[model samples]
Target chain A: MQALNQILRRIPVWAVYLLGAIPAPWLFYQGLTGSLGVDPIEALEHRYGELALQLLIVVLAISPLRRFLGLNLIKFRRALGVLTFVYVSLHLLVWLILDVQVPSQIWADILKRPYISVGMAGFVLLLPLAVTSNNLSVRQLGPRWRSLQRLVYPAAVLGGLHYVMQAKGFQIEPLVYLSVIVGLLLLRVPFPSLLNRFRQVDSA
Target chain B: GVGLAGMARGAAAQEALEPNSWEEITSYNNYYEFGTRKEDPAKYAHTLVTEPWSVKIDGLVDKPGEYDFQDIMSEMTVEERIYRFRCVEAWSMVIPWNGFELADLLNMAGVQDGAKYVAFETAYRPDEMPGVQYPVLDWPYREGLRLDEAMHPLTIMATGIYDRPIPNQNGAPLRLVVPWKYGFKSIKSIVRVTVTDVEPPTSWNVAGPREYGFYSNVNPNVDHPRWSQATERPIGGGLFAKRIPTLMFNGYEQEVAGLYEGMDLAKNY
Candidate 1:
């Protein structure tokens, strides 16, 4: 496990970016070749959304991994975040350019549909985080940068909720994703501090 | 010579219509009875018992009884029809169906004067259909049409596709094919055909009345609450293929527009 961690740490962030970009071309190829089944556009769109969510989950897990597992993958976190944003932008673009071509209808869908509204909210929240995910932003913002990047927590929750609402009927897959996201968020909570506060309250 | 001329005419008619391959038609489906996924019905519908089928013709019909599948087929004169099937989800397909008109079946049963609506029911067998185990929809999916719409010559009781028995996924034994309405209006695996004095409850309308209505006529102008009805992607069209503009009544406006002449389409939708 120590050797694996050393190897993981040695791997360049650019390599992670390269590996993350592989699925986009493959998906496009499948779509072009008619291998994406009956409704390829819908399939492509779904894949992009799922990939973005999976990447977001991985991004959320990075800090926990470094603290608990002794696997420092901090260098690649920004690359993963940027890749997640790229996937999310692609997902939104697919809906805009391919699915709903008309401008008025697209606007109506984003405004009217609860799922779309939530998804757009998540995307908007992620936009600033993606833009500021750099060494320069980190140097400039200092302590404030960490607080700003925490927006990913709400963005990730919204992303999960968007998936749950988009499903036609009661589906277990989206619910499972939501549970995992919630679990990840809960792991970040400072339980010791909360317990001390509770003890103080009881004494008072 | 007359038979040869008739064959030639049939060939010409088929040539004029957009051809949907047998593979595409067989694989893609939206039968919720088998499952919610589009391909679920095709994957899981093999368990369905279709050979020993019967349709229960009840309610206000004069000759109300359970009609045997074989008997119904023997009595009817079947013909091939090429139709454009539009789904409420804004997708479409060109299907070649072989069946007799619904009017013929209704005429056989002898419709009662008081009957104003034709309510249809899909077969519900929990043991065979795994989807029925879940309340994805109220079991035994139901759909209805006005008596006039039921009696229209364009509305057919489809038994076969591409000169073969309709696949289990595409509602084996018997199914209604209402060309002008959205695909859901053409209920699959029909087990009951009831002629009623009042409008009957439909599964979708019961589930989400705002999203699905009784009329469900194909109108590009009236968008579905969640999606646009202005355009539809043909099932077999490639991934990057452009969606075509959806037609009013799915391009059957001339034949079916008069049916809703006095009613407001948006309200009905």
Candidate 2:
């Protein structure tokens, strides 16, 4: 267990990213294979979307995880967030390219559909967060960086709402992810100073 | 009541007067793609391949024949019937479908005794079918009905939409098009039909049983667990349009209500 933890602790952030990308090629191959069972395109689109939501939750949980469990997954935060963006972009692409097909219909559908409108809102909110993910941007706007990252909280909620509204029913699975996001966000608020200091010192 | 029947007959008569065009038929759709977006399926499903088809009729049936595209459809009289397809997704499409009545074809099949329900299955193969690869829905599309429901006059096995042969994506060659129920109940691109004694679990129902029932009648009162079934926006109205109130059994309650007597839809659903 110690050796395993040590290996996990030492693995570079980029390695985690590369590992995540490993599924993209396989999914693409599956998309071609017709082995995706029932609805291949929808399957791929959903997989990308669901994983993106999961990664968003994971990224949101990082600070709280570090603060609570002394597990510094800080190195993975940017990569996870970026992967979330990558998947979200792919999700949007599938909707636009395969589902929408016609340009005029796409415009009208997005404008008219409330779920699509909210879903698009979530994607748009994620854009600045994705674009400004670099160290250069963080360094350039040091004070603003934290505030900008805060967009993820509402983005996650909006995304959850978008998915819920789309399903048009109470699907319990997505609700669990939403709960995790809420829990992680709740954990980040200023706790009792003694407990907070204790965790900080323990981590140090 | 007498006038309404005359009006319906008149409408049916007028339907025969002007055969629908392919553009009007193809553009209008009941597909639930685009997050159950009514208008999206016709657009997205253009890439589907509907040719080179065969339907396998098995299970409780005696013959269990593997029917080709030509053989099953060869003898049946094709007619243009304009139907108001009300989806469980709360959208509607008035399609001028070109196909024979399902009862005419089922009679040809010679259904035997002990056959209580009729189950339909779609062609399963995802390579040419990109939609199959997505687990967004359970694969090998399916829908089922009690034998009485299967034999209803309005139950049609459609081969074409909008006067032209059904586009490959729209369940070409043959598809079950029950006008009264939600779109999913009308299983598309049908490759299999079985007369089964047991109630066969269907695709969407298997995906989420509480939300999708086997007998998916178009009742506005019995809402899908997630969305209201009270209203549906008819297709061709484009965006920002008014949705007419959906009728019980899609306005076929008078004809089909007898089939569900003594059975509570709320529990059965």
lDDT of 1 by residue, B1-269 (tens): 23323533554333455858888788879887788777799899999999799999999888999999999999998888888899998888899899888998999999988899999999999999988877778778999999999998789899999999999999998999998899999999999999999999998899889888999999999988777898998888777667889988888776679999999999999
Cα lDDT for residue A161, candidate 2: 72
Q: For candidate 2, what is the lDDT?
A: 0.72
Tens-place lDDT per residue, model 2, B1-269, is 23333434754323333433454345445443222332355656765565667778877766778877788778787876667777676666567788887777677777888889998887776555544444566667678988888987778888887667877546666788887788878888788888889998897888888878888888888766555576665544332235567888887676668888999988776
lDDT of every model, 2 decimals: 0.88, 0.72
Best by TM-score: 1
Candidate 1: which stretches are off by over 4 Å? A1-12, A62-76, A186-204, B1-16
**Candidate 2, after superposition: displacement of residue B129 in Å?**
0.7
Best by DockQ: 1
True lDDT of residue B173, candidate 1:
85
